[model samples]
Target: MGEQKVKTLAGDELKAIKEAGSGKKKSRKTTSGQIYISSSYNNTIITITDDKGNVLTWGSSGMVGFRGSKKSTPFAAQRTMEEMLKAMKGIGITEVDIFIKGIGTGRESAVRALNGSGIKVRMIQDRTPIPHGGVRKKKPRRV
Candidate 1:
């Protein structure tokens, strides 16, 4: 009979997996990276990526133990950033270009947290979607 497939991961693949304390163990060294902050009405998610946008690690308010309405608060976002900051430093990221989205309360706080963490912010760009007139309304219901 043919050999069954093995579930084992190679050393490199194993290292790619997120660690409990530091998020990820970067295989290559990098000093500058991109920070993507997705602040929705319900929660804030921060993702760290390489210069080419390859995701290195991410953290969310929910993962930081925020619940219900607390997840949407700026404080939760700050906490989320604290978690991500540890991973960022472990991966040797010193500078970042931040891209923010959504109108949630965590939007500005997430950015400020990164800025105040001693990491140089190279740029802050708002990538929020602004509908250009948006889609047409549906026709009125027939009588």
Candidate 2:
């Protein structure tokens, strides 16, 4: 019977790993940004982006461990927004323009959570698309 020897990293390998991590720069601080919340029937997704539309971070009810119907609930949306707020605070975001889309149970609650968290909402826009008159209806079929 033979015993297998465990391999360990040498000093150079360890130093390389440490230096690689340390070389990365910290994220830039942003004070004004936009929050895009899409609350569909199945899930609520919240994304924080810079003024120019560069995404900073995002959170979703499903990503937070909510499943099935629960992901569309207000509570799950609130939790998702809470997670987003925590991430926003790290980058010094204090003001936001909120763009909301979709029809879901979480719509109002997500907005409320963001407001209650002390982040100044400059504007709230509903970006949901409303369909205009389109193609003509099909002819009635005989039963």
Candidate 3:
């Protein structure tokens, strides 16, 4: 009969294996980032990005378990910001510039939440689109 060999890892190797399997991989450390808050009539989404505009993480009211009309509420936006800040903090993001879009009820609350989370906001810019002249009006309907 052929001989069979069983191999086992050392204690340190087993510990490393366990640690790797625990799902706490180290994330890239970033000091400053950009926060994009899009608050529409139906939902509010917050995205964390690097200074160069590379998204690191994002969260939305819908992602935070809000549904229907609740998704657009200020409270839901606040909660979503809290969740996003918690995640961003893990990656060492302490300062940010806020860019806001849309005109939903959650807009201001989300900004307040971000500030309250201990992140230093450098600037807040409104990116909501405004029509300069808008499209041409439709022609009169025939009688």
Candidate 4:
């Protein structure tokens, strides 16, 4: 029988594989990165993506602290940010462009907490759009 051949990953390939698995993306033209902060009714998610839209260090508020109500607090959001910043510190991420969504209390707390956590927030852009007008519907007929 002929010998079988196997493929191997080069250093670049290995790094790419690692980055892919890490869920974080790196930028090309710019060294600065961005972080996406979102809060839903029950949880908050922090997606740390570079300028290229690759998520670097991400965390969820629902996954930490005690189970139940504790997870829904603003503190949970802070903890989630802590985890994200800790991960970013490993990758030498010092500054981030923040994009915040939702009206949860956690929104402000999370950003404020980041100040003491060693991560510099260069900008905070609220992506929430306000509806300019009411929805269209047929007028009700009188009986």
TM-score of each: 0.76, 0.79, 0.77, 0.69
Off by over 4 Å in 3: 1-26, 138-143
Say which candidate scores most in TM-score.
2
Models sorted by lDDT, best on top: 2, 3, 1, 4
Candidate 2, 76-134: lDDT as tens digits: 99999999999999999999999999998999999999989998889999999788997
Per-residue lDDT for 8 in model 1? Answer: 84
After superposing all C-alphas onto the true structure, candidate 4 shows an RMSD in angstroms of: 6.6
How many pairs in model 4 have backbone atoms within 3 A of each other, for residues 3 or more apart or on separate chains, i.e. clashes?
A: 3
Ten residues in a row with the worst lDDT in model 4? 23-32
Ordered list by TM-score, greatest first: 2, 3, 1, 4
C-alpha positional error of residue 22 in candidate 1 after TM-score superposition, expressed in Å: 20
Stretches of candidate 2 above 4 Å error? 1-25, 135-138, 141-143
lDDT tens digits by residue: candidate 4, 18-106: 87799655533334689888876677888988878876667887665536666667888988888887777777787889999877667
| lDDT, candidate 1, 23-124, per-residue tens | 565476689999999999999999999999889899999999988999999999999998999999888999999999999999988887787899998899
Least accurate 10 contiguous residues by lDDT in model 2: 19-28
Candidate number with the higher lDDT (1 or 4): 1
